[model samples]
Target: MAPSLDISDWWVKETQKGTPVIVTTKNHNYSVVEINSPNTAFQQVDKDRGKKAKRLDLFACEEEKILNDVEPILLSTKRTLHNSSYNDGDRLLDEDQSWVLNNVFQHHPNKATKMGEKIDYVTVGKHDKYQGTRCFFVISTNSFRADFSYLKCLKNYVKEKYPDGVKAFNQKYFQKRRLKGMNQQQTGMNQQQTQ
Candidate 1:
């Protein structure tokens, strides 16, 4: 759900001061799905989601189930949660239970699509990024416009006002920094190898 720009001066004000916000869902454990980003709150328009949307304590639900069902385990929060004192489920998919979903798609493609649609516990949907593979997004979105108009305006202004400044800064510090650093390290290693 994208919000229409009806209000001329509408902008998202940051509510959380970086002190860790919590979600409302009880079972989201990030096991089978990846919470790409668990943010983006919006006011609900419909009857069912209205209450949750208005709640100040709740954050926008974010989840992404890999179409291949082999979503990288690195993204899973299971280890971090289990190891940490904060065992509370952060509404991400449970990594421990993700073992059930590991080879569902590779071994059975047809079952994946069918299960995706009908299954209540496991969310199923067509993958937005990859074609033909079925992916599921369990998070229900709100009627809010997700855009970078604010960033776009800022970018345009910066581009117009400080083209040389950005270029110079990148040239001095940002541009090719990674490649240069890696090349230097590799060159040193090569020199050592030759010696």
Candidate 2:
């Protein structure tokens, strides 16, 4: 039998600030948090679990099973989602997911055509850096358009479904600083107006 978690150990430490520390022992990670009145943090965990259950149901649906033939398409989507640069309050767009999907489909058009399926849209959430985030999606073949449209659609669909957690994390550590460049044409026009 598994040992009960010591919930007190999972409390976010003052030194950790916004980041929660998770300790791994015997292959399991545990978080320490205070269990107090209302337990808003615990409530958030339940909400997340519910959302995950819903996504699993969608994955188990008959129409979605068609994507199984092109499972790699989904893997590729995961890779992209794990590699996106997102910030807090940033809204994920279907187009971003589509870009990754299109790349994957172009590489495996034949398999995609055989499956007759595509990804439609995805939902994602915010996080602090390359950490936990959720993604959800609606999958379909009918809405796919473009060369190898079916495959591209699936790729896009899966990508849009999940949050780009890993990418966001990496961004937090490796942010770049660069000066903004003015458009040459616009600058010239402004100069002329001033003259």
Candidate 3:
């Protein structure tokens, strides 16, 4: 029998190209978004407000608290990189390294195991629970951010905590619009009944 290829290595090789790596596992399609270089990701962050920004798209989910508390420096680095105008800053990357290690192996069970010293965002995959489908990937720019540890620490303390994107949007925008729509419907009904 021909030797089976390892999927994780395949994913690493594919993602290094800086393009979305799309693959099918268990009949589900997944698109791994663009992975940026560590240096470039940092540069993008530094170019912006220098970590003073309140929130970043990277920690835009409900899981932000866990990530923010565990590795605040890493969280800030990721947040600043995400807040920058650079189009290549990928927010789809997973926050937990072990999650990627576990899922990738599950999908490619026959593949050989070769562990990397560290896990980054590129190897990370995000699942779509709403759709019940495959996973999307994000690249890790840890090396680049490592250069700015002091800055990350300063930002975390001085700057306000990153806001919860999902909660804020729902409370501020979605809820208001929904209420307006309901009120308009009620007004229309009242007018028709009186007429």
Best by TM-score: 2
96, model 3: CA deviation in Å?
40
Candidate-wise lDDT, in order: 0.33, 0.41, 0.37
Please rank every candidate by TM-score, starting with the best: 2, 3, 1
TM-scores across all candidates?
0.15, 0.20, 0.17
TM-score for model 2? 0.20
**Candidate 1 TM-score versus the reference:** 0.15
Highest lDDT against the true fold, candidate? 2
Error of 3 at 128 (Å): 33
RMSD of each: 23.8, 19.0, 26.0
- Those runs of model 3 whose alpha carbons end farther than 4 Å from true positions after fitting are 1-164
- For residue 195, model 2's alpha carbon misses the true position, in angstroms, by 64
lDDT of 1 by residue, 91-161 (tens): 22455234323422222323433344333332333333322322333222332211111112223333444
Q: What ranges in model 2 sit over 4 Å off?
A: 1-68, 99-123, 126-133, 136-195
Error of 2 at 173 (Å): 33
Worst 10 residues of 2 by lDDT: 172-181
